[model samples]
Target: MGRTRAVALVGMDAHVVEVEAHLAASVPGFTLVGLPDASLAEARDRVRAAMTSSGLGWPQRRITVNLSPAGLPKAGPGFDLAIAVATLAGAGVCDPESVAAQVHLGELGLDGRLRPVRGVLPAVVAAVQAGRHRVVVPAGNVDEARLVPGAQVAGAVSLAQVAAAHGAQVEVPAVDPVDPPRSPEDTPGGCDLTDVVGQATGRWALEVTAAGGHHLALIGPPGSGKTMLASRLPGLLPDLDDAAAVEVTAVHSIAGTLDPGTGLMRRPPFEAPHHTASAASVVGGGAGIPRPGAISRAHRGVLFLDEAPEFAPAVLQTLRQPLESGELRLHRAAGTARYPARVQLVLAANPCPCGNAVGKALDCTCTALARRRYLSRLSGPLLDRVDLQLDVLPATRAERRAGARESSAVVAHRVALARDRARARFQGTGWSTNSEAPGAWLRAHPPAGSAVRDLERALDRGLLTMRGADRVLRVAWTLADLAGAGRPEQDHVAQALALRSRTAGPT
Candidate 1:
């Protein structure tokens, strides 16, 4: 019997497991008797073929391979390299001690080639967290495997290459520092803040929302440039940091959305799934262990929902908890898996059943009751959580003739300055933005010149709930930061309240 190291996923976490292979005189068939799922059960034939094709001898006696901890379910072909190495060790073809210190992950091709597996980044991360110093992955995944700090990654093209390394007959190729994978750049946004010829109110709302990291909803008729406005939001956000990049990449990796051969994702992900998407697709749950859905994938970025009223209520309701908490936890019989969801939500919708109701040139064709019901899908609680609600107006002819507007680089610089101020203010609290400040923290450090007595009066009159009051103060803090004011002023407090109490606006 010989043992080798492998990894299996348990929720979002990867755990190391020992793959033991044994061969003895008996019937000349092989069996993988472990808690392996169907995919692992089918590894037997592939392993045999790969061994033979790699110029290694397959055991002609009874063979049994066990994956421990036998109670945990093992899935995927990632165990292929480990199983192959164990077989060679058990057959006295290689030293088990030499390969025992590393974790092995990769799928085997029938012709002795190694194929890359999904979730290599997470697997390598888990191995690193568990104190493993080395990892062997498919050559195709070498770039991802090298992302783990302090871990030596070896890339192999085929089973023979790995086996040869284990026998001390050849050197395992070291992973090269290849450029990380990145998201494909879509068509550049042609609209910008300066392109809108009018509706200064709506532009101000966008500025506040961007500065504060707040949720926003734009309501107006068709051709009001609501869609165009939402499309430009990524332009106004700050660049993602290293930690955020790893988190976003991890979510994409679990969703199988990571582009092959790409090593890092630098841009903040923007997910705009169609309105017809299922609740499971939006919130991240399916037949097996749930993977990250759209919300999680859009972490630290934008999640735009255009034509918002057309989406299912179930899909819309699933966002409530995550929107407030900045994280989503999928609960299942197996376990609870949490994914970060600190996204800047941008919802664009018309004011009524017929978008023409709010258009200047078109008369409403729908009943008032129908209009009310159409917008009612978003509950009052949900709207209250949204810090900015702008009534976008149609752009004037002058705006369209100006051609494509400001680039993302210009707006990103301003957002970064605001972010830096917020960071300095919230240092030691683990908050990067005013929108993320805890209620207690806001109460303890109320914005300077904010009338605490008046805020108390508003709370007493039911104008503001405890949560709402805290959020209002957070927005005031953001306004102060954006204006380069050391302390929040009275006008900033009033403007913050105006942005927060958006329900008072006309329909």
Candidate 2:
């Protein structure tokens, strides 16, 4: 008997899987057990061909490989290396003790090469968390595995190299290092805040959104630069910190969207899923284990939905949970996979179906009911969760032709500074951003005294729900942070009220 280890990704989390192999004298056959998904079950053929191609002999007796905790559902080919190594150990081809000490992650190609598997970062993270110090991965995934600190990672190209590294008397092969993926910042012709000709209010709202990690909605006529503002939001945001970058990278890794060359995703990610995306695609679900969707992909970043109202009502409504909780949970028969979805959602929609309801230049062709029905697609519940809902109009000729405005860099500087202030205030509170701060906590520590009079007035008039009032308080705190105020003043609360009022009615 030989035992080794691998990892099973349940969402972005990794669970260490024990792989045990046994050889018995019987009809030559290979049997893999322990509830593997289709992809993992096929590892038998892959491991056999890879071992043979690497000049390793397969045990001619009956072989049984079991992924124990036998009831746990395992998917993906990540277990291939572990299964192969354990089988080799069981056959006396390598030292079982050496195999047992290291965590193996990679898919085996029929030609003896190791192919990069998804979720390497999280798997390596799991290894470290589980107190396993060594992890073997494909050469292409070396950078990602190394991102996990304190782990001794060895990157190899083929099964033969992995075998030799595990104490087998086999020759090692040399492979060139793989290049990292290009950063979004390096991509030319990117959108910038300067490209947005006018709408000072819209730009300010974007800044506030970035500063507080708040969700926003932009309602306007077509060609009003709604998409432009949403697209450039990432530019105004700072790079992810070490911990956040690793978490974001781990999510991207599980989704198979992590660029090997990009290493850790320092820049805040930006995901703009078309309105046609399904609920599963937005919140994450599939045949086997649920995968991370657009929201999770946009974790710690922006998730922009262009033509927001055009999305299916179900899809639009599905965001409410994650918006409030900052985590998306997909429940399946297998289990629940929770992915961090602390995404700053930016939703854009036209003022009307024809998108000509706004601006005096364009005659209002849409009927009153037509306009109402269109905007109503964005349910009140969904709208309430959005912190900054602004009505964007076409830029005036004067504003468009005005001298160059402040660039994303300038706004980002202010945003970073404001974030620093917020971080300082939230030092021991466990809340990193105003949006993440609990309403109860904020209320208990009320921002000074009479500053919330305007909020009370709105609540009295039914203009704000408890949730809305909580959100207004959060926005007010953000405003104060941005202006470097000691606390939210009456003016800050008033400004926050006005911003929320913008999305209160149908145009």
Candidate 3:
């Protein structure tokens, strides 16, 4: 008998799996046990072809391989290398003790070359956490694997090289390593706040959105520069911290969107899915196991949906859970997987289908009923969660010609200061931004009774839900932080309610 270790990734979490090979004194046959998916079950043929091609003749005896923790579902082709090593160990071609001491992670090609697989970083992290510090990965993944601190990682060009290192007296072949399939390189749009010509109200709202990590919605006619304004929000934001960088990096690793060359994702991610995207594509679901969706990919970043009303109602509704709580729990028959869903949702939409229902100059094309039906696609519950809802207006000639506008660098400095104040206030707490503060805590220690009188009146008139009121209070705190106020004053509450109201009238 011979044994070794491997890893199984479900969502962002990685679980350690034990690979064992047993040779029986019976007719030559190969049997694999443990609950492995169809993709994993095919490892037998790949391993056999790779070993024979490497000149490690297969044993003509009954061979059975089992992945322990039989109930835990395992998937993916990353187990190819581990199975081949364990079988070699059982056949006395390598030292079993040497093979058992390290965790193996890679896909073996038919020619015995080691091919890089996704989620190497997380797999190495899980191995290190499970007390196995030594790991062997494909040469293409060496850079990413070395990111894990305290891990003794080795890169192998082929399965023969790995076996040779494990005390097998074999002539390692000169097969070239297979370069990993890197995610398509992303190019920044180079969007800047200066590109937005005018609309002071829209500019201020974007700053507030970045300062507090709040969701926003912009409703206006076409040519109003809604999309231009939305794209610049990320530029006003800050980079991810150490913990957030690792968390975001792990999610991308599992999704196969990570560029292994770039060490860790320091810049906040920005995901803009088309209106035709399906719920599974946007929210993250696949055949056997649920993968990280656009929402998770946008974790600790922004998810901008242009033409929000064009999306399927089902897809838009899925954002409620992630918006309310910064997490997503996807359940499948195999197991339940959780991913971070902390994203700032930016929705931009035209006023009507024809895109002409603006101020009355008799240029409107859509009827009242059609306009209502079109706007109704964005449900009330979803709109209520959006903190800043405003109707963006076209810039006037005077506004356009007005002197220099504030650049992203200028606005980002203010955002940094506001975030620093919030960070200090929320020091030692799990919360970091004003939006993440709990409702009970905000009420327990709130502004003076007179300050929130307007908010109470709006609530009494049924203009806001309990959850909406809480969000309003959160925004009020954010505004206070931006203005360098010690607490929310009456003026701050009034402006907060105004920003929350959709009637932010045509400027």
**Candidate 1 C-alpha lDDT tens digits along 1-507:** 777888887546677888898988888878787654666766888899988877787888878888888876565327888998988888777788877777888888887788877677777888888888699988777877787678799988888888888883433443332222444444234545666555556666766677788888888888888877777777677767888888777777766677755566777777776799888878788654677778887888888888888889889989999887878888765556677888988888888877876645268888878888977787553676777776776766675465655554666676778889999988888877888888888877876644676677788999888977887788788778878988677777777777665432321
Clashing pairs in 2: 180-261, 181-261, 181-262
Q: Can you write out model 3's per-residue Cα lDDT over 415-487, one digit (the tens) per residue?
A: 9999999999999988889888888978876875787787788889998777888888888888999999988
Please give the lDDT score for candidate 1: 0.76
N/CA/C clash count, model 2: 3
Output the worst ten-in-a-row residue range by lDDT, candidate 1.
171-180
How much does candidate 1 score in TM-score?
A: 0.87
Quote the positional error of residue 57 for candidate 3 in Å: 2.0
Ranked by TM-score from best down, the candidates are: 3, 2, 1
Q: Which residue pairs clash in candidate 3?
A: none
Q: Rank the candidates by lDDT, best first.
A: 3, 2, 1
State each model's CA lDDT, in order.
Answer: 0.76, 0.85, 0.86
Sequence-dependent TM-score of model 2:
0.93
RMSD of 3: 2.0
